[model samples]
Target: MKNLVELDKNHFIHPTSSIQQQQEYGPKIIVEKGDGIFLTDKEGNVFIDAMSSLWNVNVGHGRKELAEVAKQQMEKLAFSSAFSTFSHEPAILLAEKIASIAPEGLNAIFFTSGGSESNDTAIKIARHYWRIQGDTQKKKIVALKRGYHGVAAASTSATGIPEFWSMAGRLMEHVVHAETHYMKGTQIAIQSLREIIEQEGPENIAAFIVEPVQGAGGVIVPSEDYLIEARKVCNEYDILMIVDEVITGFGRTGKMFGIEHFNLQPDMITFAKGITSGYIQLGGVIISDHIHEVLKEKSKGTLFHGYTYSGHPVATAVGLKNLEIIEREGLVENARVMGNRLLKGFQKLQEEIDIVGDVRGLGLLGAIEFVQDRSNHQRFAPELQVAVKVIEALHQRGIICRPVTYEGVDIICFAPPLIINQYQVDTILERLQDAILDVRKQLG
Candidate 1:
């Protein structure tokens, strides 16, 4: 087992990590086992998992019950294609379950292996739908400047982060980018979107993609009126409204979908992370009736889309069970109830810490923006890597959290497993306070 660490130290490469640092400093984490609300590393260090294992483990770790569902489905049939000819009971059941819970007009489901593929499927279907409707020029996808969709080519174009685009030099043709709410005022966000739409010409625009509550882009929650205005503009312009709920779906923001909280109608909703709570790889798009009918009735060709892992039976089974747990256990309402508690507790940290520039969130998803000098709203210099340091310090204390590096300032986002209670919240806040104080002290 020690050799395993040695081998990993010598040879393993990890995703979204500093490869050079790992080689020089050794492995950052050696997670061994996890249970509800907590995890332990190979060194026997234990801590509350505050970020829900990158914001997907909603039902929390060690869900033996969900495992049972997977075992049962695997026993019967493990993999099945959504390819036109084949059908599976678990897929049918999971679709019905999804349709029952998703927002109105989002009826049909197209499965993928995970969030990135779901975003890919979404963009293709959008372009195909426009082409089917005889509006080939309506191929542009506009996303907020700081929004995150996924890493696939099409998804990356819509992702809004210039860094994520390191894989591709520029956005794919006709894929547009817009302004996010991170700017100080609402007028800027509205004006930026309007100007971009006008410059691009609404006629050329096919879809406007957005995350109801921006997640990876720093959990920026738009003003109440922003989406309403965007919805009106899209309607006036005949552009499809695509809401990427990959992070905010399945009750992360106190609602089944973050759009549900905003009261806006989106033409499509892309989802994945929370679908099976990361117990299994599963993702899918929720299609509005208008788009669904157009693609089903007018579109020719193979729908020209699918993955070998699409609607994998075992994944669907776990998703179904994950949904069951969310419902029977009332985790959604629990998140709403408990999320408010977390927000309230976070407010205390804001009051106690002078560096905190702002604190904002919805349901259980919240963040605190740190500044070099809050009185002037002065941000710490980017090279200081203050947020990154805080995240690492928090991890050392056993709480996993992320520091969002964009949006004018750095932020530490709190999105624990929706299953957390007040006791756990307090415990986490205590460690987080220490982290906050440490950053403040070092920076000062």
Candidate 2:
């Protein structure tokens, strides 16, 4: 294992990581096992997975049913192409089950490997639909300024994080980014849609994509009427509204899908992360029948877009079992109850901690922004790395949380597994409180 670590240090390259840190330190924490909401590291340390292992793992870890289903499906049909007319039972049934649970109008499903692929697939579908209707000029994808899609070409272009662009070199063309919801109040945020559409000319815009609750953008929850109003604007301008539910889907927001919270059905919904509880790589874009029918009538040939594992039988089968486990265990209701508990705890922390500012959340998705002066809502110097220090402290105390540094603000976010109990929530809150106190003392 020591030799293996040295080998990994010499050869392995990680995504979204500091390569220098990895090469020098040789992997900070080597995770060995996960059971429920706890992860066991190589040194026998157990840590609460507060971020649900990257905002997935809704059914928690060590789900034997998922493994059993994957085994059975692999024995039956290990690999198959979803290209052309080829199909499988797991793929077909999972799509039907997803349609039943998805928002009212979204009934069609196109599977992918994960969130980035799902988002990029949605972008392609939007452009193709417009082209099929003889509007080849309508190809622009407008996303909110701070919204995060994924790291793929089209997804990264649609992402509003500037740091991603700094490293990703040139992005795809005709992708327009609009003002974020945080730039102004709800009314102005909604109006920014119209402003962007007008400025860019609606005829050139094919779709407007956004996260129902901006997760990577510091869990920015929009106003109650934001999505409803945005839907109206899209309808007014003949633009398709694409909702990225990658983090907010599958009971992350106390509902099956985040769009349900707003009472709006989107033209296309890109989802991942929680679908298979991180047991397998699975994601998809659910399109509305209206859009599907339009393509049926207007399109001439094959859609000309698919993945090697678009609808892998094993992944879909594991997804079926994962969804079943979620339903049987009532994890969604647990997320609602436990999320309320977490939010109330953070609110109390805001009262006790001077740096804690603006605790916000829905269901298991929550975050606490750190500020230099809470009263003034002033951010700490980026060099201070306040959020990073707090999260590292939490890690030492056997808790895991994500540090979000975007747009000059620092935040520590939480998205614990839906199966987390009240006692576990208390443990996480207490550890977090201690970590914050420690950070404050060090700062002073």
Clashes of each: 0, 0
Candidate 2 residues 362-428, lDDT tens each?
9999999999987778999999999999999999999988999987888889999999999999999
TM-score to native of every candidate shown: 0.97, 0.98
Candidate 1 on 1-444: residue-level lDDT in tens? 577667887878877778888777777668899899899988889978888987899999999999999999888897767798588988889988898988887789998988889888888888888888898888888888888888877888888888887755655777877778776456787778788889999888888888888898888888888888888888988888888888899999898888888887789899998999999999999899888888779877666689998889999999999998998888998889888888887788888888877888888788888888878879988998888988888987888888888644688888889899889988888888898899778887
Give the distance in Å from residue 321's predicted Cα in candidate 2 to where it truly belongs: 0.9
Measured by lDDT, the strongest candidate is 2
Task: List the candidate 1 regions with Cα displacement exceeding 4 Å.
Answer: none
Q: What overall lDDT goes with each candidate model?
A: 0.85, 0.91
Error of 2 at 192 (Å): 2.1
Q: How accurate is candidate 2 locally (lDDT)?
A: 0.91
Give the CA lDDT, 0 to 100, for residue 142 in model 1: 83
